[model samples]
Target: MKPASSSLFALAAAALHAALIALAINGLRAGQHNVPPRRPAQVQVQLLREQPKAAEKSPATPVQPEPLPQRPVHEHKPRTIPKPKPQPREQPAAPAKTPEAPAPTAQPSPDAAPAPARSNNTAPPAPAATAPAAPVKRGVFVDPTYLATETEKWYPRQAKRYGDQGTVLLHVTVSPAGRAEKVELKKGSGYPLLDTAAIDLAKSITYRPATLDGKPVSDSFNLPVTFQLHD
Candidate 1:
């Protein structure tokens, strides 16, 4: 048989132990349900660096052309040309020897053989003087207005830049049809450039046919092609 007091004490101790175990079990369960598993943190990064090989390139070789052939040297001597011979000059014949005034001498016996048959000397007739040279017809016969159509150079606009503009007086012979047949520059602008231009311009221009007796006749007309520089 156990004492009452002791039994009561023992029962109380057992009840305390049971209460502590139940509390520890409840705490374990709460911790297991509330906590999540731990995982490792991760991070990513990039690095930048230069690549030198990508920029490199090789050099190319240059091309050359073939050389030209050299010329051969010559040793032949140069030839000398001969000058033409001058002709000999002729001497003037002695002036016709006049008869020596019948050498005053004593003549007798058949009159000295009849005076040696007196020579009948005939003289050549005088040459007629050449008629005064017909005055060379001198003048121009081309219409300037029409001449402009033939040569644009006739315009002093181009010649004026070089101080070449002036009048060209000329002699012209026109056919019955007023066409310039013969044209000559009697007086020029002192410039061959202008003179040639006027001559060329006149050659192409035509004029109204001239009439002497109500009928068209080839006649000469003098005219001047004036070249002036003006705005």
Candidate 2:
């Protein structure tokens, strides 16, 4: 190669190296002067727990005054009653007098008679014999025959089927209408069925009412009912 060409090449390389060094220095200076972006400040938050509020009281209602009673209106004037006329005075009458009776006179006594001799003659008439009065019927008003018939008619069918036989005595109160008012067991039968049947029969019985001066009256009497089983 020629000396001039080499010198020119060397000068161009030196100029290129100097330009690179200057660019590197400029980049370093720009990095040193540039500042980083500022970070935002951190804020501290404190949460507070709120307490629940109490319920508010409602307002009270105002009291109303009661209405006054209305007075009666006086449209017309009151009526005035007139005084009565005076009555005339009457004179009293005189009383009449009663007459007196006359007095009775006194009588004189007679003289005694003489005794006479005994003699046989007609005998004095004998007093007529009087028949004895019939005995007055009293006390028990019911007839025995009628009571027997009623007791037989009211015989219980159950007692007959079971062949139960007994006699029950009952005290019964009879009303004025001859109807039995109350019946109490004076003597119960041996069997309960017989006793119950007898009581029912006695209650249903009607008797002849007792009489006071021929008028009917209530009376109590002992009644007997026979519950006998017969073929």
Candidate 3:
């Protein structure tokens, strides 16, 4: 319990605390040296490019094969042969007959010829007479006044309006009684109206019958009718 012993104990406690602090600082420095220095933090960087998409393929069309040509079929026909004909047999000929001889004529008397000599001077027979031929008749006669009157009466109105003008040939048959039996057109004009008018005029006109040997007879003759415009 003395003052000096107390003071020594205090100094020993202070020295132990300082020694522990110093040991701790040295351990910290040793740990730092043992760890390797950290290289700057390394970041791995890789460039990425997008790959292009593959092109789509179209479906292929199926090919059709062509058909082969066919050969034509032919039909065969059988041939026919003709048979030969038989020959005809020959015949024997008949014998010919002989002709008979002609008979002799009797002689004429001398007295019969003396009677014929007297007729040598007789006159020749008279000549036969021939009748004279009759006069030939001419063609039928048609009056000009009658033709003009019939033409004026039967003129077609349509033909006059169109100024149609042409001639028409006609064959007219006359009876023995001086009457028109038949009429036919032989040739035509270019205008149908004028041709029709001419035919009508010919049918209405009367003709004198033709005469042969002073007798009236039926006859046919060609007649021409003209349709001419007046003004």
Candidate 4:
């Protein structure tokens, strides 16, 4: 090869390399202008899955109510109370066998004959010689036996043992009611104990009241009470 031809080839090759590099730069600029802007990567958000609920229960049948209590049959019936009857009191029966006696008849018999009349001269029987009706004496005098019996219990036991016997006279006033109203020692016994006992016995004694014309009257009497011991 000639040196002139080699120099011409070298110059051509350098121009072709420079044109390819400019064309590649222009294609890159067009691609940049034509391309749409890329959107940012979409973020995937996954929610937590909710657990399923238990299945709903079916509705149950309603319960029946119990029956109410019945009222007593006796309460509805009307009661009829009977009244009590009064009873009669029993009476005592009279005696059955005894009979009443008949009354006496005083009428004379119709068939009897009449008697003859008496003479006028016959003197009427003289009334039996009349005697004075003795005045009835009604008085209670002092009785020695009764007084001794009454005062025997009052005798002092010591005096009786000593064989001391004495008599006491008491002036007693008797009331109409048969009671001794007052008693005093008219003549006292020699022993004062005997005299006091005699006075008390006189006051305690009761006597029948003296009567004048059938009516009771008061009177005074002297009574002697003797305390004698048996030998």
- Per-candidate TM equals 0.35, 0.39, 0.43, 0.40
User: What does candidate 3's lDDT look like per residue over 38-117, in tens digits?
Assistant: 43333333323334547767778878789879888777677776776776866666666667666667667766564444
Clashing pairs for model 2 are: none
Residue 131, candidate 1: how far off, in angstroms? 33
Q: Write the per-residue lDDT of candidate 4 for residues 74-104, one digit (tens) a residue.
A: 6566778888787887787876977778888
The C-alpha lDDT values of all candidates are 0.69, 0.74, 0.75, 0.77
Candidate 2 has an lDDT of 0.74
Model 2 lDDT at residue 167: 87
lDDT of 2 by residue, 1-231 (tens): 556656666766776677667766776776798944333333333333344557777888889889899999979888888888888877667666667666666444466454576777969899999998765434446677877777778777777888878889989888888888988988988888778877887777667788766678788888878766666
The model with the greatest lDDT is 4
- Which RMSD values do the candidates have, in order? 49.2, 47.5, 44.5, 38.7
Best-to-worst lDDT order: 4, 3, 2, 1
CA deviation > 4 Å runs, candidate 4: 1-137
Ranking by TM-score: 3, 4, 2, 1
For model 1, residues 1-231, the per-residue Cα lDDT tens digits are 336556666666776677667767777776799854333223222322333446556666667778889899889998988988988889888899777776677658774565566567968799999887644432334455566555455664557778666788878887877678989989988888788888877777777767644567787877677776656
For the record, the alpha-carbon RMSD of candidate 1 to the native fold, in angstroms, is 49.2
Lowest lDDT block of 10, candidate 3: 39-48
